[model samples]
Target chain A: MAASATRADALVHARGLTKRFDKLVAVDAIDFDVQRGEAFGFLGPNGAGKTSTMRMIGCVSSPSGGELRVLGLDPVIDGPRIRARLGVVPQADTLDMELRVDENLLTYARYFDIPRDVARARTQELLEFVQLKDRAKDEVEPLSGGMKRRLTIARALVNEPGLLLLDEPTTGLDPQARHLVWDRLYRLKQQGVTIVLTTHYMDEAEQLCDRLVVMDKAKIVASGSPRSLIDQYSTREVLELRFPIDAAPALDGKLDGIAERVEVLPDRVLLYAHDGEAAASAVHQRGLRPESTLVRRSTLEDVFLRLTGRSLIE
Target chain B: MTGALRVVEHHLMVYRRTWKGGMFVSFASPILFLAAIGIGLGSLIARGPVHTVGGVSYLTFLAPGLLAATAMQTAFVETTYPVMAKIQWLRTYDGMLATPLTVRDVLGGEIGWLVIRLATTAFAFFLVMVLFGTVHSLVALLMIPVVVLNGLAFGAPIFAFTATQRKDKGFPTIGRFIITPLFLLGGVFFPIAQLPPIAQGIAWATPLAHSVVLSRSLAIGGMNPSALIDVAVLAAYATLGIIAASITLPRRLVR
Candidate 1:
């Protein structure tokens, strides 16, 4: 798939990469390449080996099999050199709780061997960028979860890395906080920094990733832009019917030919069709009554349910 | 090595903000021990027929032993819970690993910071000894190296063991079973000759006991050439601990 030509421009290239923890294979053979300045994503539920793949690219975990290259260098042999040009934000906050907000960035800069004055100037600018400039002198332990996440993001950009890797950048934050993080990440993407992030949130993937791969059970199930994946795997519109508890499955047989496909969850029946309103009218013509109906456009969640036959959250 | 030094610099930077909380213990503990034990208790023991401990006042004799003991305790304290917190709780090493720093750099930097800490506290305690008139000879200045060797001898091995730990339950065990017992019987309070033959043999095997001998001899200005063997032994322990940490740290960090 144009591997030879794109190899030169790919910031991260992986072919048949695998990771094993004892007898358990966390990441099976997976192949993907992230072009320069593009925000790529690995979207999957928990225990799906997204973190394992991200760590391998971050150069913190070794690949048990196959090959991986970051910034045109092997992760195994040139780890420090490759890591020098890469910024990593781990799933959990690794900010030093003992230091002030600004000291965290300053000490991190010293690891990159940035001189003190330059590091100080960049620290101020990063704090401003993350909107944590007011908390520069305060201790890190007292900051809220959102502030800590932003501080971690700011710390990651201290070296002006060519590639930034984030693992579940907003897993536990509230909706408001998640939106703020998404905004900052969007700005970074607009500033031409390559980003690689993993998330189980379909909305997060749709909001920030230029391209994404759907990973499930240690393998990549699909790869495309969000719109293209939905178009290829799901219909243009979906009709939602909320029936009594556990009754949605019994009615799947009665609604057969009106839609391209039908999915029966425990509490709702989803109909995939070109025109959701027509599907609803057909259901009404069949003398079905006593339920609520809603028609909406398809999203990545529908694409994921179509591809995996399971809900993203469950 | 420069990467390791950067790690050391990071610790130093953190210490700058928090050193005052610990300054009382690091610099003042030695003096308090000198006043309470050396001058206070020694006065009662001086009235006995045996007034001198190997040809010097009891204060002078106990000063260097406490110096070495303080270094040993400081090394152990720095290595155990703090190292565990960095690996498991605080995850500071994980942060460093994401940068240009390697596992070897983290280990080296930690040991280097321990050396700086041990050296400064040992020197400050030495000055306290001088202020109390316990130091009798200029050769006692050699105690600094002995203190540093004694520190690494404990710090490196403890650092290695801490790297392998997932929890801090083992640290209190190290303190109770290992550190406290050594502090009591490692010739810090009195000469090992006062103990029975078997206990003396056990005391001589510990790095703390050997450093006590080296430091006491240096402080008394009666440097025993035979104590050079203690130097070699402490150096061997320090070197082996450093090597062991080099192995275990990478194993724990670079997964």
Candidate 2:
């Protein structure tokens, strides 16, 4: 009966999900669905309600209003049941400082009622999977930031959860560390684990999320695959021209016929057009002298800027 | 209740890593204090101001009092800093909740571990009492669980109070204002009856004073059925502390 009611394949289904804290509406009437075995994402700026929505889906925070079902179970009624099948990696590293790396995973497995021997076996396997086997005996306090994040990821996988929720998985790491985590997540995706992550990095969203929702100010402003969102909201390419303060004119009026849209910034002018090369030549033909010029294909950053008119990172 | 034992198991694993470091401090400090106060002062206390307290040597009278005090200090130490650490610093409880465990299980397990630690510390202190010839009868062996209850009388409420705090600055305040005063005035060093009549009323009201009365009664083979009231007081504290923790821990952790 439960499977016959909602979408049989939808692991997480939310309709008009609202989360308010006192007078502040952190997540206001947002709606989305997460399908099984897909790498889904929630993309938004800071304070844009990304973490609030993830907490709701994680079954730790009950919604203020509206409907939310995770894995065909009511979040408020069967929170523990829903949580048993879901793995969560919070935004911050919550690893035990006193316990060793392997002890962290082993202690967590006991909460799920796993057998002691089975939990130990899984701990060993997960430590190897996250490439932390060498540091299994080391305390969590001494490991580097990236190593701690990997250990946290390993700890989340101790139960072999079907749906994994990652909230800002790599927010404070360098480029090398971020890629290492991305590589591990991509492998998990290939193995058919449903992944829902929240990130502000366009490249991270583009590289990992098969589909995503862009939220701004507690509402879903746009939702689609990264490629389709870029195509729907922006032109094919963007021609950037940085000119001296005095040389640049009323660029919107001056470059009217060259591109579909023109946005002027203090340091540069963006000419949105289907043919960036053509737009650049048109600017040269008009005898407009600029300091520098570059043409590139439209990216998720462009789509985000067009939708919210603010950068993803503050 | 379902997964409370698992929570205890988790704490046991963490304790395994650091137990050896605290071995000397857990047993040796209490032994030294018993020696200095029980023997050093027992000599002076033997001849001075009304010798033969409760018709026994001064060391024997103060031995049971030290047992109760040891239980109180052990409970406070085990519950306060560790509870605050798991709530704010280590974040281990948050990790547990992400699994199948609920807030109730976590709290139950933590208090359970505190009780076990109190028992072990009391056992070590009991050995020291024996070396000094303070154990007078077979009834003294029953005070192990009694000491655990006495510790919980303080440990449970302190754990509940520490769970609600945002910072650890209040911990030292509790030590200075609440714990220290209880140690000084709660009939640990001398009989509460020796104090002014008004001070005697206040001492009898403290949880430590109740435990001291019960332990000393049992140790010297002088217990009567009326001693059940002392057990009732400690049990009430443990129950109330558990209830308060169940209510307040989820508010701070789940949201």
Task: Please name the candidate that would achieve the greatest TM-score relative to the true structure.
Answer: 1
Report the CA-based lDDT of candidate 2 relative to the real structure: 0.87
Query: What TM-score against the true fold does each predicted structure earn?
Result: 0.97, 0.95
Each candidate's lDDT (Cα)? 0.91, 0.87
* Model 2 lDDT per residue over B60-134, tens place: 888888889889988888877888888888787877887888888888888888888988888888888888888
Q: Which stretches of candidate 1 lie over 4 Å from their true place?
A: A1-5, A246-252, A289-291
Q: Clashing pairs in model 1?
A: none
Task: Give the C-alpha lDDT of model 1.
Answer: 0.91
Off by over 4 Å in 2: A1-6, A243-255, A265-267, A284-291
TM-score, cand. 1: 0.97
lDDT of 1 by residue, A1-314 (tens): 24364776789999999999999999999999999888999999899899999999999999999889999999999999999999999999899988999999999999999999999999999999999999999999999899999999999999999899999999999999999999999999899899999999999999998889999999999998998899999999999988867555467468889899989887788999999999999999987762799999998899889888988888
lDDT of 2 by residue, A265-313 (tens): 7678888999999999999998887889999998888888899887788
For B4-94, candidate 1 gives per-residue lDDT tens digits of: 9999999998999888977778778988999999999989879989987777788988999999999999999999988888998989999
